[model samples]
Target: MRFALNHIAAPNLSLPDFFTAAGELGVTAVEIRNDLPDVLSAWDPAQVKAEAEEAGVTIVSINALYPFNVWGGDLPARAEAMADYAAACGAKALVMCPLNDGTKVSFDSLVGALAAMKTILDTRGLTGLVEPLGFPISSLRTKAEAIRAIKAAGGEGTYRLMHDTFHHHLAGETEFFPDWTWLVHISGVTDPDVAVDAMLDAHRVLVDDADRLENVAQIRALLDAGYDGPFSFEPFASKVHDAADPKGALKTSMAFVSAQL
Candidate 1:
């Protein structure tokens, strides 16, 4: 299985340092967060592309565009610009997230957004990886919903669902979509005492035996069910940033996950 590291996993590191560390850890790809310290958004497209190529790292996908379904006016232009940036950075896809404030965007609106985004993606030769957030406030809560929206938008080959373990658990979804899933974000919630309702992005971290969430088991099931995609680390735990050696922490986490595979 190919391994990719998310920039959120080591938020303290610079882009060059993150790439170097990922390379040292034998990771094949790295995902960048637009909201993070070092990102493609901060650099010129050419420079970003050159830096990634020189570091020998591939850009898996841009972290996300929030409330993508409610986008209007300049949103399409912004998405197009981001897609162009991704192309310049040698990225494979753009991760689009749904509204998470319980605004109740209709399924038809979601389909419309996907169709609009797919048009932009097709024009830029990029793929749209739609990710559904499972938080109570989130409008979209399952990969199944995302899959249906993609199909409804007539984006069969242009778009795919991002299967996130944390959200899958939060959304109470038990089924897997091996054929339509393009990427998988693997992270676990370690605190059992922390109520599931209160869990947020901050609870994310590398999968471990102590995790209250069945992350490893879920991943195994996905693999067994024919998911042939990269399992990227997307830990949002603050400890990852506070650790003395983030690369060492990543190595330890990778070892743990690899054993399960």
Candidate 2:
């Protein structure tokens, strides 16, 4: 299944420890983050590469370039720097998330941003994994719109969609485009009391039978439809983050998902 671990799953771990944890869990690749471990603030790309290599794990990608839809001013510079770091760190891609603050962004703007970011990603030989946030306030909220923007931006080869199960359910999207999908972020929402619209990142957790997000169904659909890309765990709940034995917890969740699907 090529399961990959997201640093969000264990934000407390150091970058080196995160790599080692992934290796010990039998995962050969992992998605590192600039958000939590704050590698971008402290460590250089070369240092990150060395740590990953030492742990016998590969850095799948940097977690993101935020508000990538609103490209202007420092956005271009940030995109280029991130792409450069990703390239130097031996990471193959970058996750590009759109603005999610309730402000509406035009379709043309989305297209233009993708077009602009394309050059940066291309130059660094990195794929830009454009992830549509399903939040109501998110500027870009569906893979369909993202696919259209990619086509409009002439980004067929340079960009791919990130199919995040949590966001997918929130988006209430019915169609699946496995051909355009390169990475899948998985997290389950199990709270029975909260309405789907009320759900937040804090509700995201490891999948199980009690999961209300239909994670198994969604995953099976994607796999059956021919998505063979990496499935990365990205639980953001404090419960998951504070787990005493994260590796053990993740293994259990992985086994459950494996059995169900």
The candidate that wins on lDDT is 2
What C-alpha RMSD separates each model from the true structure? 1.2, 0.8
Question: Could you tell me the TM-score of candidate 1?
Answer: 0.96
Candidate 2 local lDDT, 67-178, one digit each (tens): 9999898989888888888998999999999999999999999999999999898888899999999988899999999999999999999999999999998989989899
Question: Which pairs of residues collide in model 2?
Answer: none
Q: How much lDDT does each candidate structure score?
A: 0.85, 0.91
RMSD of 2: 0.8
Clash count, predicted structure 1? 0
Runs with alpha carbons beyond 4 Å of true place in candidate 2 = none
Decoy 2 TM-score against native: 0.98
Angstrom error of the Cα, residue 152, model 2: value is 0.4
TM-scores of the models, in the order given = 0.96, 0.98
* Residue 1 lDDT in candidate 1: 69
RMSD of 1: 1.2
Clashes of 2: 0
Q: In angstroms, give how far residue 64 of model 2 lies from its true place.
A: 0.8
